[model samples]
Target: MWRQSHKPTKLFHRAQRCRPRALALLALFLVASTLLLCGIKGKPSSQYDPPKLKRSRTRTSTQFRPTVEYTNGTDLIWQIPESPKAVLFIAHGCNGRAANFWDRSPGCPYCVGFPEERLIVLHALDRRFAVLSISSSRKCWSLGKEKHVVKWITTWWIERNKLEKLPIMALGASSGGYFVSALAAEMRYKSIVLMIAEGVFDTMGIPEGYPPTLFVHMPKDQRRMRLIERNMEALRRKGVRVKEVRCLEFPLSPNFLSDRILGLNQTMAVKLIRMFSEKGFLDENGYMRKDGRATRWKQALRERGFPLEKYELLNHIQEELNLAYGYHEMTSLQTDDIFDWFESYMN
Candidate 1:
């Protein structure tokens, strides 16, 4: 009977050892199953594919598929069609966003119409060029602050889109023009287009080994145009290929009359007259009568020795009061021509 009891005790000890091992094995199995399930669930669906290269149907009607991304606290909106041959980077002017380039809402400050945007973007895509529009971090571009960041983002984008071997061109307007000009000094670009660029380049000095550049401006903006021409001349002197296109003609809208005159309240009008008189564009008598006629202003500009023949004078009085109005008018008229010029160098 004692031997029998010993046998039962031995069996009990063996069972105890096996039970712990069994529990451990069961726990491990459960963990493995859980991990396997997670792997299956987390896998990306085959139906959801990544962006693919698409062939453009026609130059005039190529469709653009735009995507927006945020990198290093900057907004980069880009359109990459299939197998792009090159890339174009566009910098927006002061208080402008990437969306402003494509957005055509009435509220958009510098809205280019949808038809125009389509024509430009699609034409680029058809020619196998990816387009990127970058917005500034602040109200205006700060090249010192944003240049490195922009460079990194642009490089990353080129790699991500498999456009490693492609050439890059830049286009900018106003403050954006200033940004690109500064950037060109640091980075290599195939070409650059500047529209109504600021006079910042004079202070900075034109950098050596800069790329070919095209400057587009309104003739009536004598101060800014003179600055651009001066820079262009300097670039030419350096043996850099540079060209300037003066948008001498513009069509004015009927509502432009209201925008020039009635848009300003009596208080604003009085202030404008005072400013104009101080600029010597109006005599004290003309200022007193609030004479905003083109004829009178032309006489003032002529007396100042401004080359009137170089400018296409619209039949309106308000052109003398606002330089921006004149600039915008030219932009509308010359959008297609600008694109054509850009295309000319793409080859």
Candidate 2:
């Protein structure tokens, strides 16, 4: 019987001898399998999360933004030097892009940039007042349904960013002019400058206790001109601090408007702009700068004291515009007048 027991089988002996190691190997396999099934990485989630860049609520897309955003949860922003104290909202007319107003567009005559795009003069003069522009999501501002656009903008900036008390200025051209007028009426902005504005002319400027307003329009453009005059009269009846400049014939050069009708150049609209502040341009004797020194000064008009608006080597923006045949547009000094008035009044 003892002899029959024989030694335990080789496999049985080996298993008994390697029991601890076998157990360890089995445990390791089980753990790995469990982790794989559960979709676990080698490290803790908190320890291995790739860093995410913080973004402002104002940024609508997860994609990187092109400009610096000062406040979170707002669409408004400042460019270039960035984070400025005061801001000017530049609005454009129907179909006008944000840059359609005041940019240099050399090689393109229709661009707003003066000297045909040599510089960004509008913003260059005053670093204190930064410019903010809006694109036309739609060609026109919602005259009725969304007229509260400016109010919403102002409220958002004020409530969340502590800009409620900061002075705001608005400048709009044509339809944009109408849009900003709505804002000027609703908000206690510092000032407003409207060129070829469509709504609230001098008409409502007084009733809303709107800050000082500077309006620029062309007398040649009769319908709008009359609306402006009517607005002014309405304001007078309501009592408003308002000013206006109307151009009957823009100053055109001998070639541009060579054989002048009414003995005037349609080219000199800028001079007409300067003349709006009539008292501001004269001396005690009430004499403005003269055009008598001109090579072609009409003897008769020189005697009448007609002053030139300084269009010497005038900006040929239309040439620059040819480059941006479809990409851009040109605005004239006729429109830039709004910027002048806004800057002056706000300061």
Candidate 3:
């Protein structure tokens, strides 16, 4: 009886020792399962994605496509919103084409519109404006002859659409700005927005009925600043209503690109920011130190295993960097202000 009792006591002691090991294994498995469920097995929890915001559907969200046509050896890319109240003529900078303000559509596959340009177009479309763009025949706009061509195209489009009574407006960037300023002298526009280009009123007198003009510029270029100032003074002297927007340099945050551009994940954004910092392209405050076009940042990114095939990502980064430097480039930062100025003249 004593031996049997001693055996049971030893078995009880053995079971107690094994119980802790079983519990430890169970606890470890639970932890691993939790990590797997949270998708933190390979990636850190800090990099976990947040909930995505639902984008409100717009009338033209899925159906907003541009049409491409040719007239007199010039390519015309255009879109008209339902019940358009006005017609907007968009002119691109030097070396840019008519498709610069539109995305690649089934109708126009060759279109390579930048985000800045696309945003501007969308803003105009949302306001029920018929947008039209014409390619320059040469490398830059031929103001002498193109103005007549533009007038003919405008008349044809207006008569075809039966929108002869709608207000006409024009927005141009860089060399295109010069073109529009010259075109305005010959034609009557309800309003004109010139970006990074001074008017040529010095050579030609500002008409008594000169349209209201809005000048968008970067003050960093002292020579261009003086020219724009001269243009503003000339317009004011003619009693033509004028407004100006001075685009200033802005710093980049971790989510700067991700916020403005789509398909760019926060992880990649953070990585790019860090890489820029390490490569001496970004200063301590995340502001670009040098012109992005001149830097070897693209090559450096390729070396760091960034996906160079993603051209959209590359383009957005390049544009944002240049914008941060406040260099002479196209911008959509003041799209609302631009449209507001245009509408104020409509009445």
Give the Å shift of residue 187 in candidate 3: 1.6
For model 1, the stretches where C-alpha displacement exceeds 4 angstroms are: 1-60, 103-119, 252-325, 328-337
Question: Which ranges in model 2 have alpha carbons more than 4 Å from their true place?
Answer: 1-85, 101-121, 124-127, 154-165, 201-206, 248-340, 343-347
lDDT by residue (tens digit), candidate 1, 1-347: 00112244543455455656634543443333222211111134332221211112113455445677778988777788777778988877676678654533333434332322334455666667799887789999997869888888888988998887888888777887888888888776878878778436676777777888888666556888778778878888887787665543212222222233212232323333334455665443332123233326556556655455654222223433332234432132234445555666665
lDDT per residue, candidate 2, 1-34, as tens digits? 0011245555446556765764464344333322
Best model per lDDT? 3
Each prediction's TM-score versus the true structure: 0.57, 0.47, 0.79
User: How does candidate 1 score on lDDT?
Assistant: 0.56
lDDT to native, each model: 0.56, 0.43, 0.74
The residue-by-residue lDDT of candidate 3 on 111-224, one tens digit each, is 766656777888899888899989999989986878899889988977888888889999999889988998898777999999878867788778888899998887777799
Q: Cα lDDT of model 2 overall?
A: 0.43
Between candidates 1 and 3, the lDDT winner: 3
Give the distance in Å from residue 198's predicted Cα in candidate 3 to where it truly belongs. 1.3
Candidate 1 C-alpha error for residue 257, in Å: 16
Of the candidates shown, which would achieve the greatest TM-score relative to the real structure? 3
Q: Which 10 successive residues of model 1 have the least lDDT summed?
A: 33-42
* Deviation (Å) of 163 in candidate 1: 1.0
